[model samples]
Target: MKSSESTNTGLVVGKFWPPHRGHQLLLETAAAQVAELVVLVYANPAGPGPAADRLPAATRAQWIRELYRGDELAQGPRIGTTPLRVFALSAEGDGVPPDAAPDDVHREFVRQWLARQGIAVATVFSSEAYGPGFAQHLGAAHVSVDAARRHVPVSGTLVRKNPLATAAYLHPLVAAQLGVVPPAAIPRVVLLGAESSGKSTLCAALAEACHTAWVPEYGRTLHEQKNGNLAYEDLLYIARRHAELEDEAAHKARKVLFCDTNAATTALYSYYYFHRCDPALQAMAAVCGQRYAHTFVCAPTVPFEQDGWRGPEALRSFQHGMILMQLDFYRIPYVLVEGSVAERVAQVRRALGMVDDA
Candidate 1:
């Protein structure tokens, strides 16, 4: 806010609850015309949005970064050109009335906010009727992009109502955060198996081959960090955190997500160790049957590498059988993928309706 920005810099403000293609168009159109662009993200004026609908300001910044930079976004130092600057200010009831108010009132509110930041923006870009007045209040020129929505034909309200149905309008980042991963957009593919069944390896290979991304076993990371000293409550945390991780990874994966594990596996481990699992975890585990597009079990045919955390070498077969029994008990159908990592990857490709290179 208090830096050495030039006078030719531009400004764009919104409550980007979830960024859609329309929003992307506005930003891109504005960015191309300015030396630098400042995107100010604010909370809903009615009040803070529901937890599920909230998109953090920092995350919006990252979206813009990814939008403009692509694979070169985070690469070390750039040789030429300035980059976009993002700021999130959620000051509710700080004298700025709700967006439903007249343009004059909202304009003054934005002017004061920018004044506080020591920014004298040259041009204000928007896709709404208030763009001219809003810019005038800040003593800047106004550039309205597509005020009619003919170009993108999407809106925040339309997206918020039924995000999954409008998944195509949303950016990958927004869709993933809103849990709008429709099958045509992004499919959640879960891999299940007992310990040392090559589940993790298969997940990585499939992700790489499919040119997508995968979610690793969060519980395994915790186990290693805790040195295999997980307690009862940890199971519930693992189940919830694993689901969150899957949603987070969806933004990175466009085609399909090869998940290393799911809440069902967590509940099974909890019941195995404590003789019972949390009801909350059990409920979440039940959702796994319908949550995933495809379920593949990495067969324990290969040698069981004895990891320090695995309970015992003999428990592998028993645990493997138990997993199959649980799947049958719940009437959840799954494919039993066996053999080397490449062969398993090929099986997954076939399941995904992709050509198997192997």
Candidate 2:
């Protein structure tokens, strides 16, 4: 291994299992010393990682580009205007055998591949101990960056064990892929009832009282957009949009997420207005039941307003009864929210154990 001053062109190769900040620093260090830098990503096909956990080679290459692209969100130091190139070595083209050991076998394959590309490697940058032999074999100087792992202390293994704990060492996109919810998991509280049952008002009040985020009724948003000219096909879309918004809000929720409605409401409306509900809406409704930890069924006791959007007041009781039946069919636990806005909030907070009954 030699110092960085003797290098004109640098090469780096690693599995980049998740491309944590340590990998970012190694690439940044190489770019600082060399006129040009090339990064190669290699993940053994026979590795122990689950197929779903293994990110595609192309995706890792894109991560390299994004990390060094000089954006504020990009991790590690800015590369300024350094010429950087990323490559994913194909198992067939690069002659990387599935059973070959990572020691000399992988090093020789890398040397041959670099030589084939007419890349005269002046320096090989790495944080691993194999850097010296790999660089010497390629007739290039080895520039070891952070051998003690001080600068950006992290590893791919450390990340996989507890992703949410070490999330600060990962790129946003990479962290998201690992299913790391940045915020703590929160209980999703859904409000359910017939239209004009004060479900929306209750949802907002609960969100404010709990000091957390809330998902508004997407069905209402779509209704206002279409001037209440909704169709049977719109039920599924509204159900899907409601779930998407709920998921987005979950990441930002404090301890709980207040939702105006769930897919059960969508399925109920579909059967009520169209005389029959679609099978897909039924499945989504079932899935929604499993998502919310708690639900509050608003009682239809208030005066029914003759809104331009709602149906006849005569159907109010029937709608309310249908919601109860659907809730029971789905086996979703819910408390009946009755009385004024303050009373309803108090009931929900008590049901969710957000406050003591005293």
Best by TM-score: 1
TM values, all candidates: 0.56, 0.50
Clashes of each: 0, 0
Top candidate (lDDT): 2
* Residue 121 error, candidate 1, Å: 0.9
TM-score of 1: 0.56
Candidate 2: residue pairs that collide: none
lDDT by candidate, in order shown: 0.74, 0.75
Expressed as tens digits, the lDDT of each residue in 77-183 for candidate 1 is 11125457777665443454665777777778778877888887999999988788888888899999999999999888888788777877864434655655434
Q: Which digits, one per residue and each the tens of the lDDT, describe model 2 over residues 2-70?
A: 244544888998878778888878887888788788888876672336732346666667656655543
* Cα distance off (Å), candidate 2, residue 278: 2.9
